[model samples]
Target: MTTEIGFVFAVLGITIALFISDKLRMDLVALMVVAVLAVSGIVTPAEAVSGFGNPTVVMIAALFVVGEGLFRTGVAAAAGNWLLKVGGGSEVRLLCFLLPVVALLSAFMSSTGAVALLIPVVLSMARRSGMQPSKLMMPLAFAALIGGMLTLIGTPPNIVVSGALKEAGLEPFGFFEFTPIGAAILLVGAVYLITLGRRLLPARTSEQQTDHCDVPGLMASYGVSGQLHKLVVQPLSPLKHQTVVEAALRSEHRVTLVGIRRSGTLLSSILPVLANTRLEVRDELWVYGQENDIERLCLSHRLTHYGSPAKEISRMGREFGVAEVMLPPGTPLQGQSIKEGAFRQRYGLSVIGLRRRCEPLDTDYRETRMEGGDTLLLAGSWERIRALEGRRDLVLLQTPAELGEIPVHGSRAPLALLVLAAMLVCMTAGWLPALTTVLLAALAMILTGCVSLPEALRSLNATSLILIAGMLPLALAMEKSGALAFVVEHLVSWLGGASPLLLSTGLFLLTSLLSQFISNTATTVLIAPIALTAAQLLGVNPEPLMMTVAIAASTAFATPIASPVNTLVLAPGNYRFSDFARVGIPLQLLALAITLVMTPILFPF
Candidate 1:
């Protein structure tokens, strides 16, 4: 082999090692690969950076904004609400509502976001319905991974492979072209999870359960329940202008001030009440009080009952609620103190409590440096809480059961729905370029105030964008250094005599295995070109083989490390690695069977 090809192969090995080691982020590993390639002269610097400008990259970024619009405007949460309503109290019935909607939504947005939005819902389902969180968590993660197979934009791998086809001068897969096989796989998975797969999942104790958590339990443990209320100070109120302590709120009103929201400011404008924080006429007070005393105090003092009572937490969840958000490893929040981060103004949530190593920190977490695995208890408008789904910096650990009952931006849901519909119609009917259609929809979402510019910007996933752009260089390096041809020739030599179905199965197995250990997007980028080359050698259509690779890359079910979706559930479900393998292997094998059987018929190899 030529030195250039040798260098390419060496870099490939190192990249794989880095991915398997889990010592660094995948996106960072990709950048390392790009730097190595550029320094080694495998690809020119211009060629290395060309991926940033690629239509696929641009489209993926645009898609994030569109998905964020849906999320920010509560389109996704609305779907979750529907699932809850339809799911009722049965685990089996919940799965029926859950798997399909999750798959449908993931077909359009980020699978991680789809799963994140539903994680709390699933947990709530577990609490209310007496089902093991284990049974529901795995099913939810698996369904989301499978959901990525349903549309061209369903997952990064789908987009990568489609881009590969386009690069080969073939028409890219159409929007919804993946629906048949993907929907079929989802159907198979649903049946498996409901029947045999449910049995395969272990009935492990949930972390929430083991930790003695629930809305009531948390309220009791924290010693802040019926005590929580919202009160608005009237202009002529005797308490106005008095410092919280000076006002004798504890002695007279029998209330303790917790937080204050000023009128004519955003929800983020809330200020925590301290000993010297003076109350204003229009200030809304978050206080702790006895129900009878609070009612009497408000009536006598002319204070408006601005907040929902603790017992009415569910009824009030639409306007406000509490949740625990943990900073998982790699969260950007690490190293920044809560106050320094200005997290409240940025995220519109107040830190009501902070816990480290399962122990509560001092009441003042303001100056505490946030670290990975530290959990923060947040209280705010449910809409703001729902918006937190887009923040990769936080893993929502224990949202109250009431959170699921809350509707977000209900008034704007219809407009968001219309924008989503328009985008889908344009893509489905070929009324505009797919990329243009998505961009327009995203723009419409902003112009119509469905999602603000900052919210749109916040929704852009830098790791995904950078990962795709960085790995795109590998495709260029492989092609330019004769490495792709070398690999494809050997692959053809080994399987040249096999039937197309066998070849397809082999390809599927290869892609699925790699995906189990690394980013599927990266796997697709490296393998898709080879699939196209192998199809050329076999004298068959490349579409089937390429499609097989795309579908297989999404079968990241067999390992906890396979996909973020899987990892996100590991701690929450109290799962062992064996749990993933036991439940995921069968699903992977089943997906492989379906892909091998269906690809040829769909694409006609």
Candidate 2:
């Protein structure tokens, strides 16, 4: 190997280690690779950074905004809702309905966005059906991968492979050129998942199931019945002039005050009792605890037993509810305490309880520092609880099922759908390049108020764009250093006497394995040229080999880290790394069989 090839390989090795370790962000790891390649003289500074200007990077970034427009306008959620309506509560029915629908949506927009939009819907289904989220989540993620095969714009890898063909002076693939094989794979995959593959998926429950405790559930689970009792304080009551803490309700009697009910209008009807809240004559204290303890405290304090507190509190639940909010990795709320972060004031939700690492804490959580993966039970008005869906800092893990409808952008659904359809027609009809069509669609989404500027900007995934840009140089370096040619020469030599099917299968397996560890787009960019070179050596058309590579690149189903779509579900599904391999290996084999059989027939050796 040449010295430059050695250097490039070294950088690649380190990058893979970083990716598997999960210690550094993938984009940052990719950027480090670029820096090493540039510093090591494998590529010049301009060439190293040239990927940032690549059309693939620009197009992918623009698509992020377009996908965001669909999400913000509730277009994606509407599709997910439709799946639930048709599938009802059957896991088999849901999986059958879910896989195809998600695949269809992914054909047009970002697969990652499709998965994100459907996660809540699928989780809702899983909870209602008593099925583990793990069972449904992997299927949701796998279907997205299969969906990318259904169209030219389905994924970046397809675009990269097509762009390579164009640059090679060959006629590029038509927009729907990928549909035949992609649809076949989607059909086979959907079948595999719902039937045999469904049996393979592990039944692991999510933290949202075990750790999310609302007020009613907590009360019932703890057997704290009849704990809520209202006591009326007389003028001569011992608690009349004391503050809540000074009254020693909790310290002396194990009784806790929930709120204070006073006379007159609704504004002063009930006030949330705080630490410094003072007690006064005729103040109705809503205390919760052992019935005997509360009665004893009431008698000792010259207080009169009043109405039922549990009934009154239960009525408050009509307008109030509890939700579980999770601080996922990369959330800005990490490292800040509840009090310091002003979470209650900012979100209008009170943090009533917290669970860290699946262990609930009885101690006050207000001063506890927030960490990634921490689940918090929040109490607030139903409206405010629902509004948490719009926030990005924390994920709303669960809400009342009644409030699960997709939030729309006010009569703009038709406009958003129209814009999407126009973009699709233009791209499919070859009226413009895919990049131009996506850019125009994104701009239209903003202009039509389907997405705001801030939302559009937020939608642009800097990590994905930068990762693509950073990894693009590795392909260039491999080509320039003759490393790519060297690898292809050996492969062709080994398979020289083999049939076309063997060569296609070999390429498919190689590409699929590499995609598991690296960005699939980068994997496609590297493997496409090699596959084409091998085709030339065998005196066959490069289209079949190239198509095999494209299909294989989308088979990133074998690892949680294989695709962003998978990573997005890791915490939500409570899946282990082994869970993916158990399910993905069989799917990969199935895809390989379908690709090897179909590519040769479609393109003909």
Candidate 3:
């Protein structure tokens, strides 16, 4: 290798190591490599930073707005209703119809987007049908992963692969070239999975219950602690006219009000802090009652409770309680031990059990790495858990029933879909660049108030942006350093006389393994350059090889650690860490075999 190339390779290796190890952010790592390249005269600084301005970035940013619009306007929800209506009553039927819809949507939308839309609908339907939310949520998430493979814009990995190939001077793939194999894998695989997965799938939704919790009964069950009983004020009742402090003495309740839940929102009430205002309807009021009078007050109000309502509570030391909180994605808790999180002290709760995506908590949760989908099995006072829910990692998971006349939402639903359809048609007709069509539609969405600017910003995953932007420089660094060629040559030689097909398959497998360990996007960027070089050295068309790379990279279905879809299911599926190996291992192997076989058939080397 040339001295210049050797230097580039060293920088590439270091950048990738820091990226995977997470010692540095991917963008920062990419920046460092770009800087190194410029210093070594491999590429000008202008060239290094220019990739950040690529139209792909603009299109992606706009898509986030579009996705947020669909969600905000309830277009996705309307679509979900129609889709589920068609799912029929049988589990297999639901899986067959719903999984394909999820996959197809995921092809152009975010997998998370698909899940966010589907979960609520599934949860609501599950309750109505006496079906399990757990049974459906995981399939929805998995379908998103499968469907994401259908188009270049479906998932970031597809775009990344196509861009990398384009840089190598190959004809970039058309919007639908991927559809033949991708759609086949999605359709056939969804069918195969619906059949086999039924027996293996569990029916657990962390909080799916026959009754929408009776707040009064729930509060009574948790057992009052420290002479304090937690409760919410009935709207426009006697308590509504008085402040917490005034209510206690005027009513001779002598209760120390500490918190309040109002209009389905919980707020901390400082009797002394904000006591001047009159009590409002829907406030979750936390009051410390006298040990003797507490029972009397409960009887007068006809109050009910959730945990052993019968148990008498005297002080904080004598009582513990339960509260339900939802886990959000990529939280620091997403893959840490409960012990490591210091969750016991942090939240003042025992690490009891978690309700994830509707599944019960597994036994090994203390040692089991916590991930986004698992709702924590918290044993503590309602006060503590309620406060904790306000944190970024958690959602209070409260949905009010008896909502009357859901404000007959306007035509935002139909209008949003129309806009999206028009944009796609324009893109297909080549009337606009894919970027322009998506961007214009996205801008129109913002104007319609379907999604506010703040919401759009929140929807953008900063980590994802950094990862994608950083990969550009890293790929260039690998190519410039000649390190990519070295790895390709050595890896090819190591496989020694393996047929082109077999070698391509082996490459796919290796990439798949790496993707399972890290972000699939990172895996694609890290290995794709090498695959291209390998294909050239082998005297074969690089199309099959590239297709193999794309397929291998996207099949991160086996471990919660491997793919977000699996991780999303871990808690909701009430899955053990090893459950991925049990269920996912087989699915993964199947995905790989299908992709390897299909890639060559569709795009011959």
CA lDDT, every prediction? Answer: 0.75, 0.74, 0.60
Superposition-based RMSD of candidate 3 using all C-alpha atoms, in angstroms: 14.2
Instruction: Kindly list the per-residue Cα lDDT of model 1 for residues 1-605, writing each as its tens digit.
Output: 99899988788778767765667776788788778777878789888887788776677667667766666665665555566568766778888888887888778766765665566556656755567899889999999999999988888898898899999999999988999999999999999998899999999877766654556656554545555777889988888888765776654555545456676442332333245567788887776566887888888878998667543444344466667788898777788876665555577666656678888664433457888998877766666767787577688776665554443345677888898777766665667876787778778878988778997897676765676677777767877898766765666678767877888887888788867755688678878977887788778999999899999999999876577677657655877656788899999999988888888888997
* Poorly placed runs, candidate 2 (over 4 Å): 22-28, 45-77, 106-138, 148-183, 195-320, 323-381, 384-432, 439-470, 513-550, 559-582, 597-605
Of 2 and 3, which scores higher on lDDT?
2
Candidate scoring better on TM-score of 1 and 2: 2
Candidate 2, residue 322: lDDT: 62
TM-score of 1: 0.59
- Candidate 3 versus the native: TM-score? 0.49
By summed lDDT, the worst window of 10 consecutive residues in model 2 runs over 264-273
Whose TM-score is greatest here?
2
Among all windows of 10 consecutive residues in model 1, the one with the lowest summed lDDT is 264-273
lDDT of 2 at 168: 87
* lDDT, candidate 2, at 233: 87
Clashes of 3: 31
Q: Please, what are the lDDT tens digits per residue for candidate 2 over residues 273-356?
A: 245667788877766566677678878989998757554665444445567778889777888876566554477665656678
lDDT of 1: 0.75
